[model samples]
Target chain A: MGLSIPVGMAEVKASKTADDSLSALGLGSCIGVCVYDPRARVAGLAHVMLPDSAVIRATDRVVEGKFADTAVPALVQRVESLGARRADLRAAIAGGAQVFSFATSSPALAIGSRNAEAVVAALKTAGIPLLAQDCGGTVGRTVTLDVASGLVRVRVVGGEPVDLYRLG
Target chain B: MRDAGRPGATGSLSGDAGTGTRGILFMAFEAEGITELQLDALREVGNIGAGHAATALADLLGEEIDITVPTAGLRRTEEIAASPEAAEAMVVGVLFIVEGDAGGVIVYVFSEADARFLSDRLMGLEPGTTQQIDEMGCSMLGEVGNILSGSFVTALAEFTHLDFGLSPPNVAVDTLATILSEITVTAEALGELSLELDTHFVQQSGQLEGRFYYLMDRDSLGAILGALGMAG
Candidate 1:
């Protein structure tokens, strides 16, 4: 019932305002990592596009939230910066769909499952507990995180938003 | 390669008109890094490439088809996903991986309604009869997109004298933002700057329409521009 600040690709956003909601729309082969601190009422979301930043290290375009290895840690840090304790943060993720079900050697086409795995591995490396995840399918999704209640939701195209997980 | 990631360099030439062809006012390609002269050369390439593509599409549909003036630019994954038309729109995308002289990805996008309509007609069924897309429909659409991509490839090959090999077409129906994100991100992750050249294919009856998107890597861009004598 409040403001919906949409998280964008390769971008990480955190909000301390209880009424604010964060969402990443139409995520295909891109993972939306949602981290929340229930006690502090802070929430953050990162729309990650690739598994590793090392692949694009040669380019100056390797932004923070563009890859799983970077996004998970960055999202945690952003929430911590917003009065949330690192240990208090918990995570839930959605998206990372194999949008095109094709047999190709390109890493991009098969990136969805790898993204899910990478995000999970990154969260583990950061010591953040992954409470729930809905990832890796043939359809794209929209992931939303409600800051006030720490509720996360997922919606496919032309479908209603359904509650996936709640952190508290 | 030098101009690939320079922000604020795009939208200089297109302005509010946005590539100036569709008349729909969607910012299909707010290009980056290329000079006006080089962009003109790229436009020439699109014109010839899409001309052949349109003919193939027309033949496939058994109807007259018109091709819009193509738009050329350098696009990042984030920018492509944030566009107004792509935000939440559902689309059918057919992808072809390009190899050989230049390597990258080319995708043809159609709105869900357009996909259904065209696929139904292609399958010799009533246009409105199909409620959901099936494997048969996807295969039909894939072949159609493959033929059109082949035509465009032939034109590009002739223009640059470069050999191109295409992988089998892969298809998906999803939100435009997601599909586009997957593509541009792939190029970025591979450390290639994505050069986008896109055009609209419109049938006279307006019953079928689609967008053809060609995203080449930095190597391809340089090679094609050099071949055309437009490289700086």
Candidate 2:
């Protein structure tokens, strides 16, 4: 049986062993990035909460996994350290949902969409192939990346689990 | 001005006393510095707000409602996400930002069952018959959330004399973790620290129960304290 490692809010985890799974649960507006290298059987997941770390004041403690701009790079580096080459990395993302819609113009209200855009942009800048994504909806999702198969599965509340994307 | 030692004057001069008590409340987190006085003050705020909300709900439903005393505390953004109360439970949430002098997010949480029950009541249908909330149901739930949260905000505004502008309520149905994640996003944007005030609601017959969370940013909390004449 493979061990399942749970990633909490604003957290990132990567696994090299084929017998492990990285999971991020209860993703609302936050985006979960899953990166995998099929040949090396290495996988990484980041629960990103915000779009840009630059908006954060210097006095505020920066959590690398908490923002899309920072988390994508951090995930790439972590996977690379586990022997997965950046050139071989493929990415799949889930979440980034506007769970609640408000009329206000607060940037925070639209953070989910902003996080999604940031993740995609970061992946492109890193030269990682964007394989599949299940994002931008009104529902919540939980994503799991199976290292052995590189299958990214997404489960929505009150809905059946679906294989959102995969990397060969 | 009356002397501080005078019996009637002490009540009027209790602002300093309240500040001293709040200081202990903050210190209590470090050690067991929370005093009965602090708890009482917090409970009083809860009682007043919850009382008003209960009245609003009862008026809307034409039924009697009851509320438990509220509990308030300071928690990290991650801690609230990992809390057992937010683990995998299906819930309906109404979230909004409190702008103006105090900035924060107010969230109203209802279990799937409770949401269904409340929706049925709002539609004047027989209770426990509806399994899901349709569009109309969602609208009703949103309005209820608005009224409940609005009542609480009004009570706090009157008590603290602070101008609090509230954004329109946005309602969503999802797992507790998912709903909490949204709140955590707001907390992350504001600050790592969140002031969490939680309360429970029960209908007169005890058939329905709901949980409400009021999340305030650290700056908002300081403003509230300042308005209350309590040291930040």
Candidate 3:
């Protein structure tokens, strides 16, 4: 088995360590942002929990990857610092499922949808193309990005791991 | 039934407080950092709330129900970000919105097997018959969750003499980490951390069935603390 690094909530993992696979597990409403530079074979993964960081940033703790707005930009920079070209970066995302889908009035049910929207908008602002995505449903998902092969995979509970995206 | 005293039954919950955890740090949107005394107050809250809930459930079923001593987890957002709770563990839960003087979220969680067991028991079906919780199964879970969570809130209100309201419960089945992470961010908005007051329910044969996670926002924390005269 290859080295699989688990990306926890509000954390980003990126480097030229191409053999390592970065994974975000049990993503409920939280989103897993994966950015890859096929040319450099370098990839970065971020697990963002919230839509934006404007309010979180004003707090006593500033987690760069806690929100989509911050995590996207931060992932881009971290991947680039690993010798990946900014222009060649391609992004793919997964997670952000409305697991608590019943109550339409509750704001908790909206976070998943809001996070997906914020991540797409952030990628657009950063001039990164969101080549693929699997988001927004009633089930939780686990996303993994294999840096060496640049293949992204997603798995739901009681299900097999399926290829979300394959980048040769 | 370990009749360990309330608050003292929690061995490691507040044991870490007097350690180096005390610093200039504070929960977001709240004025004070968590201290040993404040944690004791929160534990007592869990104790009283769970105590009342246990009695209510026992009365409803007309049977014996035992509650494990309540335990509290004051997890830092950073620690949660490092390694979430019960990674890959799935749970059937009902999320409730806390309203009135103190507001936050409370999640009533149970294992899939436990939920299935309870659902079977509720519907008077034979054990080991439920493959998956269908509409009826889910409804049973919801109603029971509603009753259990409602009892807890009533206890809090009575203890603190504050008015409280509960929203209609939203039931879900998902990974524990995912559910907890979502609650962490959603319940408090940008909260640096929220306390989780966990208590388990034991019924016939002393088997554990369900547990409750009591999460509070900054204001909720302050309100309870203030009511207890532990506000700092």
Best by TM-score: 1
Cα lDDT computed for each candidate against the true fold? 0.78, 0.75, 0.74
> Which ranges in model 1 have alpha carbons more than 4 Å from their true place?
A57-59, A105-108, B1-33, B69-71, B82-86
Candidate 1 local lDDT, B35-131, one digit each (tens) = 8677666655665677677777877777777665335567665666547555688788898888878777878888888888887788788769877
Clashing pairs in 2: none
DockQ of 1: 0.56
Give the per-residue lDDT of model 3 (tens digit) for B93-139.
78887788888777777778877887777777898888887777777
Clashing pairs in 3: none
> In model 3, where do residues sit more than 4 Å from their true spots?
A104-108, B1-32, B69-71, B78-86, B190-193, B204-206
All candidates: CA RMSD (Å): 5.3, 6.8, 6.2
Instruction: Give the per-residue lDDT of model 2 (tens digit) for B170-214.
Output: 888788898878877875666545467665677767677787777
lDDT of 3 by residue, A21-139 (tens): 99998788889999999999998999988887776535456778888998988998899889988899998999888887656465544888989999999999999989899999888
Q: Using DockQ as the measure, which candidate wins?
A: 2
DockQ of predicted model 2: 0.60
Model 1's alpha-carbon lDDT is 0.78
For model 2 chain B, the run of ten residues with the poorest summed lDDT: B22-31
Q: Count backbone clashes in candidate 1.
A: 0
Using DockQ, rank the candidates from best to worst. 2, 1, 3
Candidate 1 or 3, higher DockQ?
1
Per-model DockQ: 0.56, 0.60, 0.53
